[model samples]
Target: MTKPTETGFSAPEFLTVDEAAALLRVNRKTLYELIRLTQLPGVLHIGRSIRIRRDALLAWRPGNGGPALGESR
Candidate 1:
């Protein structure tokens, strides 16, 4: 389920790679690197598309310097 924002509009709980990258303020390549480094929480699967949770991204704070908590496999 999505959460309502200041505008009272909810955003999807899961975001595509492009949407996640834009929200993270990083290029797609960098986003992938972060996922690979396990610095950012990710949902991955074989023969399936990848998705990032909005809550995880919202919880992430730049410069905090810690691995995000979430299942990445």
Candidate 2:
């Protein structure tokens, strides 16, 4: 059974870089850069792979005080 998320909808608990990038309408490289800079939250590093929590992504917004996308920290 699918569980309701904080966003009031059901989504995958984790998202791959490509999946996340698509959702954010950004390039995969840009997403990687955000992850590398530790700007985006809820990043999980599993071996050589990376995963992002859907709830965290849904909660994130530029107005939340995070750096603007593509801006250097």
All models, RMSD in angstroms: 5.8, 3.6
Candidate 2 lDDT by residue in tens digits, 1-73: 3468778987788999999999999999999998988888889999999999977987988464766767755
Q: Largest lDDT belongs to which candidate?
A: 2
Q: What TM-score fits each model?
A: 0.72, 0.74
List runs of model 2 lying over 4 Å from the truth.
Answer: 1-10, 63-73
Summarize candidate 1's per-residue lDDT along 2-68 as a digit string, tens digits.
8788899999988888999998787998887777776776555436677888888888776745545
- In model 1, the runs with Cα more than 4 Å from the true position are 42-46, 64-73
**Cα shift from native, residue 12, model 2 (Å):** 1.0
Steric clash pairs (candidate 1): none
Worst 10 residues of 1 by lDDT: 64-73
Q: Global CA lDDT of candidate 2, please? A: 0.86
TM value for model 2: 0.74
